[model samples]
Target: MSEPGLPPFESIIAGLTARPLARCVVVAPHSVEAIAAVAQVVAEGAVLDLTGDRARIKNLLAEAEVDVSAVRIHDSGDSDTAVDRAVDLIRTGDAEFVVKGSIPTADLLGGLLRQRLPGRSACASHIYVMQLEQFGGRTVLLTDAGVNIEPDLATKAAIVENALQLYSVLSSARPRLAVLSAIEKVSTRIPATLDAAELRLMAERGKLGAVDVDGPMPLDAALFPESAVNKNLAGEVAGQADILLAPDLNSGNLLAKALVGHHAPAMGVVLGAGVPVALPSRGDTVATRRHSFYLASHLTRSAATSPNGCDRE
Candidate 1:
């Protein structure tokens, strides 16, 4: 049976067949985990272009029972070069998105940044979209968990904008954003609280576009109405945030892992790029990887059709 807050795995795979399959470039695709992820996505009808050691990747794919004829392979000789080649495919429009394989996150991101791909945001951030069954089908967005380590105020704003853009694509309604902090009130000792306050002001001044932003809100208050009331917080976003902007990567990463560890349904994507980036952790299960690909595929199609398209140069 499907989890209450999440769609069934088979349903997500079936849904992909109705749309044009995204051409994905996988960097350093030789490890068992990476090969498994690729094969799973291939089964769902995505076109995969792999970059890595050709012989090794082929062997691994064969071992995984994936039909070699279906995938396009690019032999880049080494991990660094494989990542570079994958970025080039995205740059040349040969692929719709890039997925990390056996390569390190830093190396993959380095190749992409060096290419200076058009439509890339000033600061690319990571967003984890989580579905909590306990929340009665609520989808929550967490930002900068896997990318930005300690973003400054300007970078934080950019992160929020990137997340908001992606959320706008995934959701029909304007999303309510909660800038997370340790407490519900601003304190000079806590820099994040101050940053959150300023971010809220930015939203109010029409600087952050059409979104309801609240800040310095604790996690409980952000998600639970009773907690917000107990804290004497009264606002549309106080207990109804669709997005939770983490103070930094540490907090965001911890929060995301904790939820995932407890078996909550989640998927992550890197925003602020020419194409959507599916970045499932190495430790993530095959189910999570497949879901990430499904989300990235949908986002790719949505970005292409959006009025303010994501592929703008």
Candidate 2:
């Protein structure tokens, strides 16, 4: 869902580009796209820490003609070692944020979660930011696509909290959240609906802060005004949802992939961890990965200045 006067998603991406690039560690950058993406970031003046095969990294950077003056390498022969080293960099404040590269996402995230970081334990979840043409180029946020498989109510609550933290970083306005399900009515038979209703109640009780929460909503009713009108569903978030909390990882991942498959302007990040993590899929283009880095860096900057910061852990 959209607001009339808010800046477009493209503007946000452009703003991120205009800002000085933050220190980032690219973990296991062993793929073509990862190299290309990091190369572009380095060329654009980002100080980067790379953990991977030294020879392969140098060859690729030379091909891209990226200035190695600003790049630091921690040669690791194994992907797991690379991932662990990246986490250590963040844990030691050597890097502001992390960027996923060639390694399996599970390996990178497992390292981040299981390792003893600076902060206390927190539930980590992935959040996707996308500009969908179908929504009139509106930017939407979707959560748990990269983490949280089949979250229970407590985990869902944690995801919502993480999304709200991200929304605050992205906008000054209060975010409208929609807990999406297959239908728009509360029904005991559908577990998602039950969860949605409870979430809405939690919002009403100020448990989720000063945000507007609506749910047990179908996709159409959540974002499209016409659908909400036809369905007689009216709420602050019914047709203007800024954040979407999916029922589970299966649905969340599929919906997020659908948007990416359409080549929508996009970025993904993992929050609620001790540190912010940029998420780049195996097949993501250089542009996508670059934007993800910018987004994660932006989050890092925002958190650094704020007293609460973004780390839920």
Native-to-model Cα distance after best TM-score fit, residue 289 in candidate 2, in Å: 1.1
Candidate 1 stretches with Cα past 4 Å from truth are 1-18, 134-137, 302-313
Summarize candidate 2's per-residue lDDT along 44-91 as a digit string, tens digits.
878899998999888888877788998899999898889878877886
- What residue runs in model 2 are displaced by over 4 Å at the alpha carbon? 1-6, 302-313
Worst 10 residues of 1 by lDDT: 304-313
lDDT of 1 by residue, 1-313 (tens): 1112223434544564457667788888778988898898687666789999999998999999997777999998987889778877876789888888888777777667666677776577788888756655567888978878788888888888788777776656777899999898899999999999999999999998888899899988988778889999887787777889998888999888876675577788886666778888978888887777777777775441111211111
Each model's C-alpha lDDT?
0.78, 0.80
RMSD of 1: 4.8
For every candidate, C-alpha RMSD to the true structure in Å: 4.8, 3.4
